[model samples]
Target: MNVQPPEAYATYKTYSAQLLAWDSSFSAFMSLKSHALTALQIRGAALLKIHHTTATIMGRCVPDPTDPRSIVTAANDPLIFSQSTNDFQTVVSLSQSLVAAAEQDIQRGNGRLAGGLTFSTDMGVVAPLYYVCIKCTDVPLREQAIELLGRCPRREGMWDSVLGVRMIREFWGMEEVHRQLRQGMVKLVLEDDGRWEWSWRDLHNGGEGGGVGYGVKEMLESQI
Candidate 1:
């Protein structure tokens, strides 16, 4: 059903230049994934795309001793797209390297990053509870964290993005963190001018950030 994957793989093998040309398109596609887009994922994809593109274009324009033209040539080959070829194997190795780097970057940022943590396994449903809290008592970090939450929740890999409702209840007892997060949400709403989607816009704009009618004002009242 998905012919794109094979085509992408082939593009990686022979005409690396062709693949390089598609870099912007590929990035746009990746961005549409939303919350699933991680800093590391973005970085790795950029690095991979640029490396391949540069190699292809340079190979045509000028020769370089440091570049691995063989790998680039193999990755951009057209035959590999029709059938799995040795070029795919080379691409696979490169992919593995990128994945490793991405993982390392995530760990460095998340501190105690657990690939994917789950609580219950009933019906194969794992609780969604992704978070992006910073250990700072300043406006910048807090504000940035709020913005991060607003954007990140729309992504794919995040638990909050996927299973926030189920996970929120689990953290009900942690008032301090919960309150801070609530404030962050409020900031998101105010910053967005309350004109976004009250239910999910992360702003007062009436997206998802408004809560179920009670609103941030009512939420604070009830909490206190």
Candidate 2:
């Protein structure tokens, strides 16, 4: 709470670099310690959604004095909880902490860059774009996310555009995509030729585990 003026900025810079480098390797670094990352994801998601939907979220949110330590402990340790007593402040500080922790892991160096958001690398590469998308609240962060998606590297047959679209759609109403997919007469599918095509499915049969492809059917079906 009483960080020296220079210490916060220095810390931010250090962590920012780490956040930029998170990749497939990240998962391994977190293999036995993934509860920390999971906590970050859950807390980050809640705070980002609140900010995105309302255009504002309290800079801090005081935990109920009676709130169970187990719940709060998942996201903010006692140290963080004591310092960031507001929603917005907590979100920002947590972002910094996550980045710092990730960078430290990478500095120790030992992972692979195969898949997922936390890919590892022998090199010091980073993926700040994803961090901004999931963290930061200002206009610049949104712009950065859009720009990064446009230029993100591809793997196998999957492209950043596909994942980018998913992220964008999430910012909008996720349920709306499902509703449209169900009611619409046509479903979109990717062809062997790498072309997108449409198919007809019965809406009545559409839903979780019901339609042809409705597992996380709500989100994935939108691509159709």
Best by TM-score: 2
What is the model-wide C-alpha lDDT for candidate 1? 0.38
Q: Across residues 102-219, which tens digit of lDDT does each residue of candidate 2 receive?
A: 4454555621212233423321112233333443444444454445344333322222444654676476444344455576744667656556544445567774324553323221
What TM-scores do the predictions have?
0.21, 0.25
Question: Could you tell me the lDDT of residue 31 within candidate 2?
Answer: 67
Please count the clashing residue pairs in each candidate, in the order shown.
Answer: 33, 20
lDDT per residue for candidate 1 within 1-224, as digits (tens), equals 11234554444556655565676677677778746867656545644553453333333432233445565554344343324222223333343343355356456775223222222222111111122122122333333334333332233322343344334334443444446556554332322333422121244555534543333332221211
Residue 74 of model 1: what lDDT? 49
Q: Pick the candidate with the highest lDDT.
A: 2
RMSD of each: 20.9, 18.2
**Could you tell me the TM-score of candidate 2?**
0.25
Instruction: Quantify how close model 1 is to the true structure by its C-alpha RMSD in Å.
Output: 20.9
